[model samples]
Target chain A: MELADEAIRLADLPAADRRTIMILGHEASGIPSEALDLLDRAVEIPMVGTGHSLNVAVAGSLVLYKLAGLL
Target chain B: MELADEAIRLADLPAADRRTIMILGHEASGIPSEALDLLDRAVEIPMVGTGHSLNVAVAGSLVLYKLAGLL
Candidate 1:
């Protein structure tokens, strides 16, 4: 996946603001070379089940809430 | 939660278009009357773990993909 492209497209926000953005995925290290330059941070959530990833919005919400000090 | 408000705010789209939208949550039946009028559909996903819900984006992606006949 073009994670940076997805992030940029989905956010539709300014690049300066994108610095605060965090991209979390199961395969963070596997992200394409093109996306590395765009991501501010890439996080991987540890999972125990066969299901290895959390939904993007759920991950986004967790990070947002943590950054906002809500969780 | 003001689900309708959240959906409206997040979608940033037109009302007519929102009719095609579906709001999925663990507590679908508990949605407020205000939201019932706004949502095109409400879905609930069965869970096996303490975690009772999928992230909204994951849920959204699933629904979107299903609607697009991709899954």
Candidate 2:
């Protein structure tokens, strides 16, 4: 899934055992509309900082680690 | 701690309650020797991919989330 505000928290995803594919888009604009349409769900990483969001790479890795149950 | 071959796993760190400060440096060279001298330990995020290492932002964010115990 892609990152979005209304999406579920990455931590709240059902289980780590299920294979998953994560789509990370541009840091500023996010995934293209066409690509987003192909995905079934989106996930968000809750942040308390003033920054707009975490870097794309950082966001992607965090999701991967969480989905892998490594973090 | 910085990323290193012999460092402990970020997940293996003692507890999430401790306050921690993470220093992330250039993706290619890593934390400079001067800064490395001041750090007491290092932690690693094991990878199964062929990539040499993760992007600096990704690595840093992962560490931060782990330290925060939010992952």
Candidate 3:
């Protein structure tokens, strides 16, 4: 169990720990339950605007920037 | 001067100061020089990856979150 003991920190992990960070974009319904078994946590973005959706590439970029501590 | 003395702190301004924040989306060529005169500054997102662009809404949302201290 190479990564068995390693808990997925979700997107909440510190920027410095991103070397092994893996990102998977999924449908609005969410990452399939089966796939969730392979991961440790479901990262969620908190939104305050009236808009309820975010574009994938933009969201991806935002997460990357946040992970890199650039935002 | 209603707001003539204010400098458009650019995207670098603190999130809480967004009441007067006006964001302008434009082409890669950038905001026209004529429009630049009306704006106090040009905001920029620093990127470290090979990807050279970010989608407008995602980028906009990021700034809004940053301004609101959500990120």
Task: Using TM-score, give the best candidate's number.
Answer: 2
Tell the DockQ for candidate 2. 0.52
Pick by DockQ: 1 or 3, better one: 3
DockQ of each: 0.08, 0.52, 0.35
Docking class of 3: acceptable
Q: Per-residue alpha-carbon lDDT of model 1 for B1-71, expressed as tens digits? A: 23443343222232233336565544444566775676654443333348645565655554453343322
> Residue A40, candidate 1: how far off, in angstroms?
35
For candidate 2, list the clashing residue pairs, or say none. none
Residue A52, candidate 3: alpha-carbon lDDT = 61
After superposition, the stretches of candidate 1 with alpha carbons farther than 4 Å from their true spots are: A1-71, B1-19, B24-30, B38-40
- Output the lDDT of residue B66, model 1: 36
lDDT of 2 by residue, A1-71 (tens): 45565579866765467667788877678888888878777777777669877766677777777777666
lDDT (tens digit, per residue) of candidate 1 on A1-71? 23443343222232233336554544444566666667664443333349645555655554453343322
Please, what are the lDDT tens digits per residue for candidate 3 over residues A1-71?
01223333223545655364545545355555566677644455655668665566655656667677676
Model 2 lDDT per residue over B1-71, tens place? 45665679876765456666777766678778888778767787777569987776677777777666566
Interface RMSD, one decimal, each candidate: 14.2, 1.7, 4.0
lDDT values for all models: 0.44, 0.71, 0.54
Full candidate order by TM-score, most accurate first: 2, 3, 1
Give the alpha carbon lDDT tens digit for every residue of B1-71 in model 3.
01123433223546674365645556365555666667744566665668655566666766666667666
Cα error, residue B5 of model 3, in Å, equals 19
Better of 1 and 3 by lDDT: 3
